[model samples]
Target: MKRLLFALTIILALNVALAANVDLDQLDIAKFSLTTDEEKTINFEETEYIITTDSITPSEIKLFFSPNNLVITAKKEKPIEIDLNNDREVDFSLTYLTNLDAVTTIELKKTDLPEDEMDDESSPISDLNPKDQVNDILASIKANLKFLVYAVIVLIVLIIIVKSYKKRANPERLYSKAEALHKEAQEFHKDGDEETAQELYDKAEELREKARDMENSEV
Candidate 1:
């Protein structure tokens, strides 16, 4: 009994060691790139970053932003979008650190928007009232309804064509299906249902014959 207990203890120790040695590099970490032509320059007011990892909790990851000065520890994996600076152009760096010693850093420069371009009146539809905007949206939807109907009809036709082509192309599928039915029929026979089992067997045989004919035609 003592020998058996020692062996079990050794096995448990080995399991614990293996579980603790999980490599972060082997995990599926997503790569991200900025929308700007120059990564060092942040042309947009708001920047977005998507954090992703395989089987790792978001709480294990930490984010640190410098110059703009922001720190966040995520409770869940989601896109991080924030305004770096609203006054003028500024350069900042974002650093991501994981509990598993994985690190990622991104540097960006923000650009200031022109005063005229930043005005809310610059929007084309900003002058329209709420009722007029609703009417315009309804009119646009009504105008597109006929095109939407045509697109749906085309999609349905394509689906039917693809299904028919697959049925013609895959004669082996029928044989595999027939084999499954035969196995089920044998189970039904074992259960003492002779009538149902016979029907199933007959159907299986019919499918098998069809498959054979299709194979011969291909030859």
Candidate 2:
């Protein structure tokens, strides 16, 4: 009976000691630039992390990291605390910062605080230093700004959808859509994507012709 108990204790200790810590040391490059539609993945210590550029926006880089099957969306200059082992303690932190040029920087740091001490340290907001407070404020502001931008985009899309469903055809509406298409085509042309640019240009010309027909019919 004594021998069995001792062996059980050792097994439990080993299991606790072998709990996984997501590693980032396998990343060969510290910083890299990714264009839209480009992605990079790295595997380390049985965990995989992936980062990619935003497909819709060429200037933004979006990152997806999975540690212990927990997906994380990274934001610029934000440090995300992760609990890798699911012990309700922070194991490490990862910060992703991106530039306007689509260059990204990754930072990984291991937390030194013990599991129990972490709870005590986090219980008080007054413990944070001045710099941390400022960072928190800035992050809050950025989050609000992001939400507002998304809301505006959604509103614009809703307006366009509603206007399209209406029975009356407005020449001004068609002209505005043609103008928007022309702007998009110009961007694609500037990027040297001639095929996409030409497609958009053709669509803009079609819209312009429809607008002219509507105007002549009304007159």
Q: lDDT, candidate 1, residue 108?
A: 22
**Alpha carbon lDDT of each predicted model:** 0.47, 0.56
Q: Write the per-residue lDDT of candidate 2 for residues 88-130, one digit (tens) a residue.
A: 9875665565556644555555466455434543232355679
Q: How close to the true structure is residue 149 of candidate 2, measured as C-alpha lDDT?
A: 61
Over 4 Å off in model 1, which ranges?
Answer: 1-164, 167-169
Candidate 1: worst-modelled 10 consecutive residues by lDDT = 21-30
Candidate 2 wrong stretches, greater than 4 Å: 1-36, 53-62, 66-69, 84-87, 113-219
How big is the positional error of residue 18 in model 2, measured in Å on the Cα after superposition? 31
User: What lDDT, from 0 to 1, does candidate 2 have?
Assistant: 0.56
Task: Give TM per candidate.
Answer: 0.27, 0.29
Model 1 agreement with the true structure over 53-165: per-residue lDDT tens digits: 22223253344434455445443333343445545434322323233333233222112334443233224245557975676556544534454565556556656766777
Instruction: Kindly give the number of clashing pairs for every candidate.
Output: 1, 0
